[model samples]
Target chain A: MELAKMEALIVDDHPGMRTAMRLTLSNLGVTHSQFAQSANEAIRRIKGQHYDIIVCDYNLGPEQDGQQLLELLRHNNLIDLSMIFIMVTAERAYEKVVSAAELGPDDYLIKPFTAEVFRVRLERVLQKKSAMAPLFPVLQAGDAAKASELCNVLAASHPAYMIDFLRIKAELLMGMGQAEAAQQVFEGIVSERAVPWAKLGLARTLRLQQKDVEAESILEGVISESPEYLAAFDTLASVKDKLGKAGEAQEVLSKAVAISPNTLARQRMMGDVAMRNGDITAAEAAYTTIVEKGRTSFFRDPNDYVNLSRALLECGKNEDAINRLREGRQSFSNAPEAVFAASVMESQAYSQMGKAAAAKEALGRAMALKDSVPMTDELKLDLATACYRSGDEAMGARLMDQVVRNRHEDARLLQRVRKIYTDLGRELEGEQLVQSSTQAVVNLNNQGVLLAKQGNLAGAVELLTEAAAQLPNNQQIVLNAAHAVLTLVNREGWNQDLMLKAKRYLEEVRGSNATHPKLVQLQTLFNDVQNKYGSRV
Target chain B: MSGQDEALLPAMLAASLHEVKNMLGELTLSLDALQQQCPQQAAQIEEMRFVTRQVSDRMVQVLLLYKNDAGVLRPNIEAIPPADLLEEMLMEARSLAGDRLVVSLEGEQAPPYAYFDRYLCEMALMNAIHNALRFAHSRIVIGVGRLGNALCFSVEDDGPGYVPAVLQRAIEPGGHSRDGGTGLGLYFADRVARLHCNNAGECGRVQLDNAGVLGGARFQLILP
Candidate 1:
């Protein structure tokens, strides 16, 4: 495409900088250009029109920075990946460099540059974009294999982009689930030069292959060598979490948050890991930061307020915890889970403060909404604890029994459930209950499996489906039911009822235990069934 | 200063420098537009613009060195095609010189890409090019190619080479013999060069030599 004919958008909050960029863009022979003073305005323009090039300033003032804007644009699929996006900024510090590099813009230009410098950078980006223009359609169509093949051909033909092409090729390989090939490509790049991004790519490939130790070592080297590489920290945190070192994972996330606290996802991760490790203070701080920073992010969740109040209560700050719960209701009253979790937390707080009457009243309110509220296992645990402390032993035992039956194999969650009963002076009873509940679920799963093997797929699915409803917290039972339903569907040839049941089972455990061994296989099966039979239904 | 205070000083300086750089950018735009209308006085306007650029370049150098000294400048090493880097350097040199001098990129045409921090390398080359523009006799040339195992970027001019006394203390930043020179330009170049370490753990180095393509002083930044 001709340089002058392509449209451009210049985004900078400072008018002087915008005017300067306009002159620079005009000098490069770009006649059609637009300016936006903030990321919001830029997004509106971007959504309304398709500009060939966008020059965005890194600091877009308060609404959203360039990085967040780019993330939102990419995340929402509002902009095609092929557009030429150049990040311009005055800060050349490693902080900004790391943040911008993580986003992988076409080019980045530091400010205080001459018009000549601007033109040279923009032209280089345009050259790279135009060279890869043919592959954009395949990539946008989500044809990973086709995109990888086309990228290889284009890289061989256009040797000038061989290095960048290799990087893209590795990424495409990863997207296509060819982690071994991606690792090979990344290894080749790292052997040539220990580029941090390439090293990180290799680490991610190793991670995809479940080589957590190898990925963790490489990630450790990356962050130590380049302290400002925030993504490495995040990767290392997850790797540690996978390795079952929740404390280390929390530490890694804390380090990352120390460097860049505005990332709400990292803050949330930090809170989760800290809570899992039982570091109430750390979890409280992380959740507080999340609540504060989440105001500007689209990722804001009402759960943060609930988690923050729970953490405060755990830290024995009853007054502060009560205040947080009150604030959560005021802010997120529309979310039913938030309101229910708030009542549970309030009951627990009041019980801990020796206000028996108030605690009993709050627990009643929580129990009254039990049928209306969609319950997660964590919420069940909270309500059970509240009920036990508020002198509702029978109700607490029922809820705790449900938790034990559903997650019998989850030792940590089982331990937490046992603790609720033990704290209520029923340790022996809780142990017996846990043992019996676990045995019952195991027997049900075994029988279901036997039925499937004996060609009684329908009977197996029926048994497991009923078991899943009774033991809703049992992921193993749910997955077992899903598998039996798929087996039954395979035999019966597209049963809409079985497909819906299988989908419901899979949906229950979607984000929870996504790392389960059979989760991916089950999801793939469910998707295949939907694709093959969804239309007829 | 305490470590925390030392770390904050560079950020403050960079922030203030950002404001100054924006103003300079605006001034350059106005000067560039005015130079077009009044070609008769283009030389004087170009000279003023050169000074503005130099001031901005100095601020960048200072901020970079501060970050480097505080151990905060982690080089984002990457495989950079030399042709693109030199092309960019030549463009900036052309704008700074306007019609006063000729600027061109010379040497290797293909990509046996050099691994370095592209931004810092570009800034270092711009500094070298700016220095060459001040001393060159109507012509400046930038050379990019492999020198043995190192990737070398050199700016050469037709003007007289560096004096013997200045050459003696060439590598010592802030130790130059000249009173007028800030001595920061070469210092930044050397710092950036030294940051690029090879697999063998050998850092890069900078060199000063005369009688290059232009037969004047050649400021070479060689990275391993």
Candidate 2:
């Protein structure tokens, strides 16, 4: 709680900043501070030690900026709530600063600041962290209900921390799947003051309640008033996509990318949306930026290159497409999925160029590599298309069947399968295959749910878990399996092996759709039961 | 110039300014360490620190001017408590003045909150406080209060008030003092004040007047 007792890390590529910060900390009687000259070094230092405070410059030379580094830490669950993160940036870099707001740093200090100002800002951050000290330990220990209660009491009594406590309370409720309670808190905060973040939170709560039209309008107002709010753009685009307005989502993502092109996630989103909407030029441009800008960071996904090549091939740039696929394979040589996708793309490009021998060779390599990597619905779709185009209709149909059996409820994928069959002039056969596969999976899911509803928790869990293992790519089935496990544990008491199985399914679902409502529900239920009954393992 | 080249010009200027500021900061730190070792030369060291701060402040003003000229200067507004704002300025003054002058904040009747760009407002206020500390006979006071609907924060000194010509030039746009003062600080403070606008279409403004609570020169920034 005291400045002298705190351990601090200063991250800046500039020696002057490092020296200046050391001097300032020395003035405050702090002696155990460390300095890092780059983001990579900062990450290494942080991983090896615990720092109470981090003073990071916004720009850290040519690699990942402070925001991207923070994103990586948060995505990997590396940062705990107790540590204070202060982003130091220069004046006139308002766009980046605004964008960083969503990353949830403790505070930001504009550059060209004096030691006195630094002390003030640091003290403020410390005071706020002290106020939040009691809640984080409870929440991190997986006690959401107790944490929510503590926040309610704190917000009711502490006027200074009322706003902050309310904001935390809302987020906790949202994480606990109590959307109505979170919506109430967000609405109260918005009515008291027209803060853009509070309004955006309210929109998210509305979305969770399936009031998407109202959420869209609220997001529109927030975005129009605060054009620099990148998170609002992302949420609005999702709302548009859910409403079946793919064009609007693409436009929203376009605006966000224009404002802050350095963010790789937004570029990927723009590329995906463009490809889905059949805008080959836009898809190619977005993926091009993603591959080029993400090359230096851990965010570089081989899929961006593969997708770009596909867009190019569609646009009739066969030579450029082939080059892209080759470069992609070189960039992500260790990732089997990336290599497989690249090989598939290569076959597609070669076949489009009328090089049948080359296409056949590429297809052979892809089929050999496919068994070594975990199969996802998206990858299977790509491989199936490539197989069909290479004159292997039987193998293509088998792969399509695998995709359908894995996700019978995915109407969009079913449509794609229909189009593929129509292209092969076997529409009737394709329809029969789709109907039978979807019916079989649907019957298994219904029976499991029925077993759970009839109080046969063990039977339901066994059936669904086995089914999910058979059809690993089925998100709905995995989610249901987790739910069944959670209910069984809640009623029948703790079982360590079953708990691990549930956690695995929840994690798998999160990997594919992190924001899915069903995944959130299952996650909350699983954590609640585990926290209530201590883990035996 | 093409659009890309034009944009690069400002970026290069900002980067160069940043490098120079860092060097100045390092020099200030070394001087501070030097003063601790050689207490007899503390006055001389303080004078050097003052000069360094002046240079840094001028560079900041030039960068701000360029940003405004390029139409890229937009305030990031935040709500700051009055006490915290005043305390922050006093800290900077203490670092600059050392033991040569006293600096304090007076906000007994000020409002609880003020909405403005904290970074810009602090720079403007620090410049005024630094100027006052130099001219003050022995003490400077930063006064915070409400003037009608606008919030006013002023820096006042106990030394002789600003002369008639200096006071006249201070308020006028593009006017410099005849006594070798560039008056960039005053111009910058004025511009920062005018950049803040309230929902009622009221823009912030600056006032320079003699005979304050300290019976000396006063620089006040009033924001709506």
Which candidate's DockQ is highest? 1
Quality of candidate 2 docking, DockQ: 0.18
What are the TM-scores, per candidate, against the unseen true structure? Answer: 0.83, 0.81
lDDT of 1 by residue, A59-170 (tens): 9887678877777777677777678888887766524555324666677776656666677777787777888988898887766667888878988887768788888889
For model 2, name the residue pairs that clash: none
- Which residue pairs show collisions in model 1? A406-A474
For model 1 the local lDDT of residue B111 reads: 53
Tens digits of per-residue lDDT for model 2, A17-134: 8888888887987777999988778888888898888888888987677877776777666777788888888654643365435665777776656676777788877776787888
Q: What does the lDDT read for residue B57 in candidate 1? A: 80
Q: Each model's DockQ?
A: 0.39, 0.18
Q: For this target, which candidate reaches the highest TM-score against the unseen true structure?
A: 1
